[model samples]
Target: MTQRIRELLDGAVADLEPGVSDPVAAVVRRGRAARRRSVLAAALVVALLGGGLAAGRQLVTTAREPAPAGPAELGRPPVPRVVGRTVVAGAMRLPIPDGWTAVENDPSRPCGDLHRTILLVVTGNRGCQNASVEVYGSERTYPGGTLVGDDLLDEDHRIVTPPVAMTLRGGEPAWMSESLEAADLAPDRYPEFAFWNVVTLPWSMVMLQLRDDGPAERKILDSIVTTPTEAGVLALPDSARSVSLTTPDAKGRNLPAGAARTKDQRTVAAVIALLRAQSDVVDDSAACADPGRPRAAVSLESATPTMVVITLGGGCQEAVSSAGGRVRLSDATLAQLKTLLGIGAR
Candidate 1:
């Protein structure tokens, strides 16, 4: 019985020691060692569980605590001085006074279209009182012999003075017309002189109209600085022979597969004229890289191919060119070009 018990104990603690010459004594020693190891393992497990519970409770407490408050954010800065500063209205940038505020017409309105008319109203107290200035321009060219003075005159309203020839600050010829009555207004209620100074340009016709304010309006008119015409506006390279429009392929290819030649001479001439009359060059260097494929492309066949790549649809930049030495087209110029190309306006 004693031998059998020793054998059993020796087998249970066999993992503690592999080799044992004295079976009984080896079993006794291994049994004591195994008991000690079990006690140590139990103590280690309890310690780990206790530490984990304590850490978990600390995390819960931290999460339940309220966050501290912070200071409020600062407000936006005040509007800058407008005196002697340039304010952009459609394609042209006009000078405005410090006290005057400019308001653009709604884009949905007929006069708000940049290609048709760009109307900007300048007011001193946000009302059409005795002192107010209105600036108007258009991208479309007027008919030949169109009189600016005749355009301002109306048979319904009172005429303060007849149309007279005037000279702008740069010696440019202008027509000055004055009226005692205002459009859609009563003369007795608003007894103000309506003054109109119309100037014609190759690209568009601009008019500066003031009501009952001569000196202030004249000062604003004198401060007007027209945008300079960029080079290569009218100069078409002699190397250029033909122009063509290319559309993208439906199979998601970058290659110009769908090519269509534009043989309409009148359309081509209109496009050229519009390009020649571009008054402003907008900086589009920071424009986002369009991920979508181009819609249409205008290629000018020359010794060195001068191309104007266009990408229509939403969230796309206007005409862009991969060819070097191509001028960047402004919004108005791009719209005119697109219209001439039968693409219509955006």
Candidate 2:
């Protein structure tokens, strides 16, 4: 197609009018898929014509804390700007770089949103790869529900590649999962999700993932672990105290498999609380429940269900007697735990 024709088609494709119930209706349920593809193809021609930045170059920032003004620039490429710096506690801060956005809807938890694509960039060592971290949400709503549409680029992550059906966004590879369960009990309707990562340059990159529910996003988002640095994370309220939990295993009369399942349940609960807490606010985390194994953990938002960092400890699984598995909380941590449990913070 001629460049002019392509541009025109591109505009039409981008305009796939989906209403509220199906905002993504344009690409998901409607017959506009082919047109959408053509538009994305045309737009890619324009992006290449302007500058050939690859898919992994797009970065995202999702810090609620205001970015430093006139702070020392790391002298990285100009494409990715300083989004925000989160101070989890003294001597530990993570940088939320540019091109990403934050999400804050849950009343209980409040971590900002960083586009998943941005995480892939840093994870794979594309840009500033020194153990970079990013957070994602299954409940998040981007321009297109699926990562395949050109509208996908409109998100904080900004899809930069040519439109391809079920293509990888950024540098991350693509994988899809169906019927994943969410960590939170909240009701969600999304059922299909896709994921992949892209390494941009030695200093930066882009990572992408889309899910029908928040569970997969939570699990994966909860898995990101970052190195402690002097940058500092977001501060919790004075009322906020570092809290921790180690839920006890309830498997009693079951066989070894049942006991193992019970142990997993306890671990999952502990991890969920940790993840939910991590998505909110509480500082300084370590696995106290099962020190022998890596407990699932993540950094929480200051006020909402925003996930800062996530990881599965105990190497993702471990075995233990019922009595041995108990979720423990520090006295100070217990104060914060009450709020999560709706028991009022001590």
Candidate 3:
């Protein structure tokens, strides 16, 4: 796993440790996405504090602006400084700070709902869209206590000032909390700010979430702002990167005869699509030579297995007869199957 992904998974594990009622309870009560959203909103509190950006706006446009020509690549003041290759999201280019760890996701792995998240531990108290800023592109809101895809703040268990604690990262004070529950909450109060930031890209969605607020957030933000874009060096380490399938090729690839379509195929197809969507990563060149051959191949890369090459060759009917007279794709495999079902020409 990439450093970023390891930390994220570790955070989730930490939240689940015994006696850690706050984070665990919050997660169980609210949910992973909700908790992540809430934490992100908290970190963003500072960034959104002064800026008079529109709130509750539903932005769904595609951002395709090319990287700036010179060193002043990161956005203007108050935004995270980034050096190296700027990540392109929906309508914006994200800056990657220096000295922070990053994790690249595997292209072969199935893409989750969150798509991808970039984690950084920076110094300073100032906040800059702490959540998934790289995925949703802009802040947004869903209906009925639902956290928007790009919402920096999480409202799964809505509260203005959720319970909080302090931690350390990059030699800075970081803050942690489960739900934002302040005593003086209004009936319909949404957090003033949190950590979720969504940036949309031409190929896939990117989400950035700040688990804590302390030296880490500041350090990360600072690096992003200072990193020079001229050299094409992304100062911030991309601990995790992911590529997905651009399309499916059912006509050329082979599948088991009598293979019944299942929901798994759809899920896997989505992940494949996401991986192939990356601008830097190229799609698999090999195509399914024969759709009726009961065989197919998929190419992918990520943190785990740098490249996952799956070759499917067996009629569903034949496999079923061999394995307890039944043939079914594992839940995980189903995800990939879904992608194949949807595959089109590259």
Candidate 4:
């Protein structure tokens, strides 16, 4: 797994430790995209506890909680520093305006609804969402994941407003947008945040919960100028200085266990360009899709496989990755990839 992905899911192991109240089966079902992390967590448990159900039970019995929140808290700032009385989320800085109290979601319990949270700064908090949920981008794989296709659409299937242009941390293109509509909201409880900043690409929607027709409300809104977090990237890593293609043999039957290295510069450039340019994942059934088959598997000894192109039926460039990320390549980019792998033609 990539360092970023590992960091995102590092807490998952503790979430499954014996006496967490949440069952193993439940965590598995929810972590469809977290298969790797779950496996690693299991192996670590076996290695640490000597691989016995009885030992696992003993650990659970003595453990008061699934995991403590101290470690994460210690790593984070006690409070984000504010400048000019404005808090910028993309900067990971919180602006506490008078009565507002800013708090980061617990690493283990990120998806849970905030309790009495005034101003919140969400960083790398993601989860599977079904039914009605208060969080933004819940339907997507995660921030900067899943293809936005032609336009950004809301969970209601309604077309969201065009995205406000932004940049990724790498200075790559990205967007910001609104999330839940007021109608999509469940009953408002304590810490019921009135605003949310979600990240999706191509075009993004931005939603504000507070009404602004009233003069005072507009004044309040204008007082605190903020921006959403910069998008994450699926681009290939520099460590991936070499590339290889694993494919089936002459009969097109028994695929070899080993991969052959490709020294062709065109092929290398194409692969890197495709990965660098890509920023989408797809699952559209039939609505305007470009499709392509993965003729060969990529073997990058240096970098973790962040994403792989999937058959999206929309474009040959679309792909799904190990981290559930989707990337859409251009027709030319797809053509280059196809040629390098000897898919259709070189």
Q: Which candidate comes out best when scored by lDDT?
A: 1
lDDT of 4 by residue, 145-183 (tens): 111112112221211112222223322222222212222
Give, for candidate 2, the lowest lDDT window spanning 10 residues: 22-31
Candidate 1: clashing residue pairs, number = 0
Q: Candidate 1 or 4, higher lDDT?
A: 1
lDDT winner between 1 and 2, please give it.
1
lDDT of candidates 1 onward, in order: 0.32, 0.25, 0.26, 0.29
Q: Which candidate, 1 or 4, would have the higher TM-score against the true structure?
A: 4
Model 4 poorest ten-residue lDDT run: 22-31
Rank candidates, lDDT, best first.
Answer: 1, 4, 3, 2
Q: How would you encode candidate 3's per-residue C-alpha lDDT over 48-158 as one tens digit per residue? A: 333312221222222233323331223211212233556433223445444333333223444332212452212221123232222233221110122333334532222
Better of 1 and 2 by TM-score: 1
TM-score, every prediction: 0.25, 0.21, 0.21, 0.29
**Model 2 per-residue lDDT at 26:** 13
* Top candidate, metric TM-score: 4
lDDT digits (tens) for residues 1-346 of candidate 1: 3353334335433332222111110000111222343434323332432222110011111111111111001111111112235554322346656655555433333422122122253211212222255454321111111111122232112111212222233322233332112231233333344323233221213334454334444555566553322213233332234445444445532232233334344444444444444433333232322323334445554433334444444444344332211234544554444444444221
Lowest-lDDT window of 10 residues in candidate 1?
Answer: 22-31
Greater-lDDT candidate between 2 and 3: 3
What local lDDT does model 4 show for residue 90?
24
The segments of candidate 4 whose C-alpha lies over 4 angstroms from its true place after superposition are: 1-85, 89-100, 104-236, 239-270, 273-330, 338-346
Residue 65 accuracy (lDDT) in model 4: 21
